[model samples]
Target: MDLFQPSPSAHPGPELPELLPLGPDGIVVRFGRVVSPQLSAAVLAFEQAVQENLPDGVTEVAPSLSSVLVRFDPARGRRDQVLTALRKLLGGVDWLAETLPPASRIWHVPVCFGADQAPDLKTFCQLAGLSSEQAIAQITQTPLRVLAIGFAPGQPYLGYLPPAWDIPRRAALTPQVPAGALVAALRQLVLFNHASPTGWFQIGETAFRPFQRDRTVPFALKSGDSVQFHAIGSAEYSALKNRSDGLGGARYEAGA
Candidate 1:
């Protein structure tokens, strides 16, 4: 069965936080099929809980939009043993009601949303029924949470912009977008850490380097961190283009 999908025949019980094997050495703890802040909270809480109380053989815990992937060492323990430990841990608390962890950091990243930096800006503005200026205002006005970091090293998925921005991903792919490209779709924004092909519309560009191998912490943004984007002129973006610091033109606070 497709473990990720909701199949009544595959899982008849009403109990949630379901467990499905992800192969011999991994298990997927699914909170639900939908993606929302509350679900994300549960995933984060469970991830933290697992980290604090891992059974033998468990090697890693990674949280995604609505689930946690628990990987383990097959030689250390059997899947049933790990499942038993997870079941016990899951029973210890009501994870669904758990609040998000405290914000670890806050970032104010600068972006240039103009035509030159963002070639697809006009296209997206048209689709959202927004003018160029209006689009920039909407995107920069609020701070989005760093929901998850994937697709590329240190790349962040940030979102839940107003409903009007709840657009779908493009039908066709854009051959390539450079590192630091800011794209939008599904009411979320993705800040690319490296050049890549994508289906999301390119709406802006930033100088921030989310991943820097030279840094002690290669990934700049952690999952629970907050990020607010501010607009910058072309000249300013040019000035901040490639500074020694990997932050580009972004500034951050230690704690939320």
Candidate 2:
């Protein structure tokens, strides 16, 4: 299908309403005013299709929360041409859930939340008017999906935290959290792969290194994978850590 044709620039429209250029090499296609999973899924479907087909003059097609950035050479096709291609793809896209790629990953990440392990767990409980156990229970009860991985390499933002779990990031940042730290905010839980400072409520720590440079698959997680963080204590994390290599993975089947 010619993803280069123009249509109405609205939801499900063939023509994108706005096209912003990234210098002379790239263009950002704005699908809507805000980031919605529906829009993200659409963007991803298009991205995957483009990756599989690969258009001429285009080098990269990346999908963010609600927009797609297309990189191409102006010498081969003007910015307009790129937009034409995008419009055609957007128009041709079929957003049925079936068209979306399977997540292909379900990871049971073990975590140690609260106290020294999670400095802000108590605070999150206080803000939510719940006790620590209730908070942990709430977190463990819900399964989260990898929303998008960015703002840092291999760093992922997972979401739709229950309303009771909603809270804003702190005004001040905490010291860098280690790789595998589980944090929550904005209805999202982020699993850190690299040590980076963050303000999201630190709820737990896991040995599951999300990013590993030596491995062929550097990032252990990807957007679309399902995750459930099981709570444990420092000693448990220690036992898991000590025998991690023996287990052969940062994570394994929960019961296994």
Pick by TM-score: which candidate is best? 1
Candidate 1, residues 1-256: lDDT per residue as tens digits? 3433344543344455788888778999989898877888888778878988989999988888888899999899888788778876776466778888766688999999767789988888788898888888888997788878887788899876777777788889999998889999678889988889999989999999999999777778877788989999899998888687778878789764
Q: Which ten residues in a row have the lowest lDDT in candidate 2?
A: 247-256
Q: lDDT per model, in order?
A: 0.83, 0.68
Cand. 2 Cα-lDDT: 0.68
Error of 1 at 219 (Å): 1.3
On lDDT, the leading prediction is 1
lDDT of 2 by residue, 38-69 (tens): 66566566666666666568987766666667
Per-model TM-score versus the true fold? 0.84, 0.76
Clashes of each: 0, 6
lDDT of candidate 1 vs native?
Answer: 0.83
Superposed by TM-score, candidate 1 places the C-alpha of residue 38 at a distance from the truth, in angstroms, of: 3.5
